[model samples]
Target: MYIRERRRFVAMSLAAITLGACAETSVRPRQLAGADPARGRDAAERVVCAACHEIPGIAWPRGRMGGSLAGFGGRPLIAGRLPNQPDILVRWVRDAPSLIPGTGMPPQDLSPAEARDVAAFLYTLE
Candidate 1:
């Protein structure tokens, strides 16, 4: 009985570890480090992001000029061009026009840290 219980415990532990690893991989480290989704949401609101794109959590000043931010995290590409990574996403948020010339998404006045927070919030959209 002791051996059986020990085996079961080990199996459960392995399963838990595997699940945790999966969860961690889904979100990049940059998005996880010192990133606050709540603050990102607030930043989005302050920056009037909803004025162009329809954000899932924020429900105000929604506009149709930009693509909906729904499922943004799951997307494989940013701006339908760059890879969907934390660094790339942050840069895109900070200066979309710089990354992609003529992008309708105007450059934001957000600082680097603010952009990271925004990226964290966006990563939660999945």
Candidate 2:
């Protein structure tokens, strides 16, 4: 099953890349250059992102309400509303409703650095 899923992911990734879904835009370094994916992974656990998001590496929680972030890095948009770029992701992580009024996601208390770390980790899902 794992092999099958991996193959499916590869096929979908190829399709997305062919269709320009994963193209780097003017807003680049989508994962935040110099930010630490390892630290971000740790921060994700501390921040309890897994409480709402089904993050890639974290095992517990497996939240159903906020939806899975399985392939979020390759996705073209954030919250199906905004372009999925680094700055936008950082802002979204800091405060989701500010970016889009009435967004289901609530504002988080992470510092700017922590937000960057979380964004960095999230972008690794691709």
Candidate 3:
């Protein structure tokens, strides 16, 4: 247990350092053209997204339930089923349950634009 805690602390520290470097820069979103990454970063916090997913930029969550999105940009699939492409990613971000019935996530209630922006921010993670 002590080792686990120590590892967690180290990993969290590394994540903070890595994300701090990219705090001001915006990666061009591949999923949706013209999607604003900065807005996406803010929207993720506004929506309390880290409640489910371990997002890279914001460090508070460290969610235990959902998977970490540390390298979402390079991932090959969305839910281990759908291909991680632009249109599909945008839709998945907005409504995971719509794509996969009985999915654990509830309706995210994000607008189309907000979803696009959130998706953009997710894709920025290296």
Candidate 4:
């Protein structure tokens, strides 16, 4: 009976360890260490973030145009609705124009991965 109990305990422990290992096997997001502004600019281009909003390095409208997202990270609220968290930012990037009416910013239509990358890039600013 003692031997059976020990075997069961060992099996459960092994299973728990295997599950923990699996949980850690996902692609870790890049650390939030200050990213290269230039690379972020490139990422903005790839995601076409400048199509609506004026990004840092992308060639944007010369005159009075869309709202300047220069200090977007510092903003207290997104469109005065959602708080600026990574998940919230991803959601906003994925669907903003729909989320808010009369918002000049149109949805850039990014995938989950693309949105996450953009969020990481944006967090680098200040």
List lDDT for all candidates, in order: 0.85, 0.82, 0.78, 0.63
Clashes (backbone N, CA, C under 3 Å), per candidate, total: 0, 0, 0, 0
| Per-residue alpha-carbon lDDT of candidate 2 for residues 46-97, written as tens digits (9 for 90 to 100) | 8777788898899997777789999888787898878788878889988999
Per residue, candidate 4 scores C-alpha lDDT tens digits across 1-126 of 999999999999999976754444232432434434455556668766665566665675432355657766665556667556666676677777666766766677566666666777765554
Off by over 4 Å in 1: 1-30
TM-score of 1: 0.75
Q: Rank the models by lDDT, top first.
A: 1, 2, 3, 4
lDDT by residue for model 1 (41-83), tens: 8999899999999999999978989979998888767877876
The reply for model 2, stretches above 4 Å from the true place, is 1-31
Measured against the true structure, the TM-scores of the candidates, in listed sequence, are 0.75, 0.75, 0.73, 0.56
Name the candidate, 1 or 2, with the larger lDDT value: 1
At residue 36, candidate 1 shows an lDDT of 91
What lDDT is reached at residue 106 by model 3? 69
Judged by TM-score relative to the true structure, which candidate is superior, 1 or 4? 1
How much is 101 displaced in model 4, in angstroms?
4.7
TM-score of 2: 0.75
Residue 45 lDDT, candidate 4, scale 0-100: 81
Worst 10 residues of 4 by lDDT: 24-33
